[model samples]
Target chain A: MVKKYTKFIFFLFLIILISSVSYAKPHKQLSDYNFFKDIKNQIPRDETVPYKIANPLFSDYSYKFRFVHMPLNTAAEYSYNNVFNFPIGTTIIKTFAYPIDERDLDKGFQLLETRLLIKNKNGWEPLSYIWNNEQTNAFLKYTGHTFNVSWISNNGQEKYVRYRAPNVNQCKTCHEINNKIQPIGPKGRNMNINFVYPSGEANQIDFWHDRKLLNNIPTPLKRNPAIWDDAKYGINERARSYLDANCAHCHQKGASASNSGFYLNIDENNSSILGIYKTPVAAGRGSGGLKYIIDPGNPADSILLYRMLSTDPGVMMPELSRNLQHEEAIPLIREWISQLK
Target chain B: MKINKKIIYFMVIIFISNFSYGKIIIEPGPNAYDRIQEALILAEPYENIHLSSGYYEIEDGLSLDIDNVTLSGDGLDKTILSFKNQKSGAEGLLVTSNGVTLSDFAVEDTIGDAIVVKKANGIRFLRVRVEWTDGPKSSNGAYGLYPVESKDVLIDSCIAIGASDAGIYVGQSERIKVINSEAKFNVAGIEIENSYFAEVTNNIAHHNTGGILIFDLPNLPQQGGHDILVKNNKVLNNDTPNFAPEGNIVGKTPNGTGIMVMANEKVILEENYISGNATAGILVVSYLDEYEDDNYNPLPNKIFIRNNQLNNNGFEVDKVRAEPIALLTKNKAPEIIWDGVTSFPEWIGLSKQQRLILGPNKTKDRKTDMINLNLMTYALLPWFHKTKEDYDDYIGEGISLTEVNFKTKW
Candidate 1:
């Protein structure tokens, strides 16, 4: 009886070892974290771990679901106002999807494609994995593909947009800084907000700390970075934060639009660089008859507002991934500018 | 052993023609996009990337960062590269390499610029047609056939249209020639800004906000534009409404203006047909009239205009479009208006012969502000077109500048 029990335990151990080895690299088509299935487990397999953010860059009303998987025993360095220094081999995944009815949050969504930013030896490499129509699996999309996505808005209106999945080079358009590829979000301030993680609701920083995935972060953190849409923050703070995340990626110093002499970052103390009574450099019809980028105390005459409200391909701000204007944010920005005095 | 010297020489010629210089033809299909990108990437120096006649819809910007590579299509109209659905990046095709020639193709409807050649030298655009499919709209891309911050460039036999900014623009570069091109229906039809030693000749600029603009703008990485030649070009009827984005410099250009020069040294305009514009045929202004640009020269020095036919100007000036311009000037503006603004403290230091040189031109019956500085309200506003009290004071012809020889520079 003793020999029989020992033999049975040895066989089970052998089976577990073999399965774990196979799970390391499932296939080239599928991600290492499996499909969007299991996410919160100690060794998440088949199940997906769900995550959310306080604010996200608008993408034509398309909702996003993000997940992260870290190799065990690895930790990310702590940085302020910048992305967490993640270890090599960490994979950050975001799936672009849309709800059946945008007015109803409870409505189920149709998954489109998943973008992965895998941290490699050089840096994070961005790739797109398109989900099949049947919602079973996703395959690596080397070349970009486009498809029609239809949805219902809160007003009970039918809407549709031709969604374009960005190709690999397009991914580098925003991710690149000073010729180096980096992540746009996941900054310390963006992640400091409370999140409904698997172990109930808590600050994401604490959650990451408890999971031993982050370096030494002080208790209560260094600074509270305001999420742009939160009403608790001041309007100036919120508006500047929104512009920093969306526009500064290309408009700041040493960026693609550096020649334009515009800076929308949080650290830019100069009000003029934030587009106060500033003349445009090469904005042809994008000006919309507005004399300055911002006419202090007059939001109606500001070129900033003109570009925000416009949908014309050349006249729009934050050039891509959004066809519709962020109507809700525009008013808040207008109010912020009106009170600039 | 002097056996068959003629046969050996013929074999040598065949070998040289076959392998050392060869062409690779790429076909169109499902795999063509990736195949072409790979060919562009894997192409070696002195290699030719030839594409068969077909229409291609590319989603991402195509970039070439290698040297001595030539990309050619079957013909300009036969091969079309469209970037209407670009996901990211700015241009349809971006180049950061030297010794690259893009020829015999049409790039249309890009999200941003059609082709942007930057920070490289010895680039040439031959028999290329860059256009926006939609007619002149404010939402069109900024530039077509753009080359910035490169040297020894040639843009020959090209057609550009429907750009929000300049149809054909060369900026912050040196030793360039833009000849035998047609630019129309854009903001500034053909603009050479902040560059030195450029010859723009034998081009047609029509129906734009301002045809043929040479400006030295402030707050850019490059400044102090000088030594440009504008000759043998038809700058006609550029009365299109300004559709440029509000912040760009050209966006402020009034409709129906032709051949604008601002803050440059040593420019010669000669032998060109300048007609049918409403505002003015030749407009020279100081940079101080526009923005608060510090440490930059704002004077127009050693300019020579000769042997040009100017007619029918100020006929259909769009006064309501740019009301500030109309508020300062009359309905019949002028054939040549020089905003006589000079901040030189030593007023008596320079002779009259050292100023702008204008000669050998004729215009219709008109009494206008040739040196109009009536709008110079210093310390009042940052008006781009400043007013000068002595706007029509100076009359003596200055010394003619030496003609820039392109054959020697190139």
Candidate 2:
């Protein structure tokens, strides 16, 4: 009986030693583990209830996104495989997993849970990704279990970095292609999860419809008294600010365009002097001999569209150091160019 | 803290030294001359006296014996050193010491020479202009720039006009160079006499009685003027309709030569655009009698005249006679015999046989008729009769009336 008890204690000691060693190793290589295998199986096949995101510290945040419906024949008639041609309301919800340092993982999860609120018809709906039997939020299956959230202060004095699902490097590698200037949330090609209701209306769609925040959202019919004020987030201001931050760093005077003599300063109100909205006669960058980058009322012919769609390092947008292609920002830019009549 | 205090003390010493060696400024007033004299007495070597931009009219010439000093002004146009009423026999500014530089000022109507540098070496005149009110023929004033017995001299970006003698006269000087300067409306734009190893390049000698002259005349003790180079100069509009008094003949100095090198050995005249003159573009004659025996003889050697473009835009001969002549009769005694006969050299006229050997007729046939006999006799006769006694004996035979019907073209 004494020998049997001693053997049992030795077994317990062996198990404890193995568990502690596993936990002590750095988590940099943990991404190789299939953490999403079980969660992906729970995602619904129906397009309306496509997926939900969950993490170890949060509950489920229900969301679904899809391409706009089009006639089969009409889709087949278009030869070019461009995703930008889809109807204006088309969207997508992507999901991924990121392994972070254990010390930061707790804070990352807390920040994500606190900021995960959905703006519904009535008001903002406070929500969290549902946690499963493994103590992880179920919504992580659809919107990635890990995410990085960062913001530069309005005055540009400081930058704050927090991780809800992923650390700064893990999220920024794909999201911050042209640095943190690009939107990483899901409303666009960013990390923000887009939640849709059963009636197929986008959450926060009021900013585009009731608030008139978007200038280029086409309406089926004209209604009396516009839904929202026109001053907020007008398409011109949005597109101009976006291009200035993303493209003008190297294109303005004394930068890379020092040889080309083409300056694109965002503050310049004179379109004639800025050389925008006009064909670049001798742009060294090959965008298929395109005369202009922003053709009025015709985004298909613009070279800017070609550049944004290209994954080729020789022809990519921003021309340097961009990782993931900004899928949503490209379409918005295309729509802005299309509406430039 | 100890190291910091030591560094502070070191920096203080450096600052104090710099303050003690700062530039000194000189302002002109009633006591301006007195101040300048005191500065000259106390100036250390490598010091500069910067004169403010103003007019300085002196009753007497200012002389300096300071070495390695510069008397500079704010600018040439603003700094006026007027000696209009000064009766001083010395120059307006005289420097006897070496390494003296004067710049950015003007000297006008000095009673004597405008500037005189004696026994000075490495003297530079930068943008300093000297002029006289009387025309180029005026005998009251002489030697606008007289640098005698000096060495290693440079006269750059300066202008001199209306001198009784040569506008820029460098006598008995060595290793001198004059560049990017102008001598216009003067008796002689530039005259380098008894100078060795000199270069006169990139200058404009225009509208003067005589353009550029390199003469080796006898009478001076210091000889040996050789290896002089005159290149890339524009000598134009020198056919001024005024002569330099009775004995002093002028008006482009005959043959309409833009550059005249009389008795200069090893002289290189290259890449010069000499145009708009009445005579040949370049005249190289050996005036052996003009100089005393001991004076420099710059002749009897190689002279390279190459790449010169000549245009005969000179005035008519009848117009040449209208110029006045100012003869220097002070040292020139009256001739004991005033003979009506004058010897005209055969080389003066364009004979058909002579024209064939002289290559081609550069001047048109009408130019021969325009030759002023009186001016020619005055310029050549005195020296000609003095040198050649047969010129007095058989002078009448040389003056025969001959006409040739050959049409010449310039």
Native contact fraction per model: 0.43, 0.00
Q: Per-prediction count of colliding residue pairs?
A: 31, 46
lDDT of 2 by residue, A1-341 (tens): 43434545455545655665664221221122222323333232232123221101111121222212222222111111111122222222233222123334333222232112222233222222423334344432212222333433224433323223321112222232222212222222111123454446453323223333322333332221111112356676666656654565555543323222244445656443343444432222333445555567777777777766764433455433343356546766777787786
Worst 10 residues of 2 chain A by lDDT: A53-62
Give chain B TM-scores in order. 0.86, 0.70
**Candidate 2 wrong stretches, greater than 4 Å:** A1-341, B1-22, B133-140, B241-257, B288-300, B313-410
Q: How good is the docking of model 2, by CAPRI class?
A: incorrect
Highest DockQ against the true fold, candidate: 1
How accurate locally is residue B281 in candidate 2, as Cα lDDT from 0 to 100?
A: 50
lDDT of 1 by residue, B282-319 (tens): 88776643454465787777677777888887666567
Best by TM-score: 1
Predicted candidate 2 versus true structure: per-residue lDDT over B116-221, tens digit per residue? 7765667888999998767555443456777777787788999998775567878777777888999877767788876787888899988776678876644333
* Ten contiguous residues with the weakest lDDT in model 1 chain A: A38-47
Cα error of candidate 1 at position B403, Å: 12
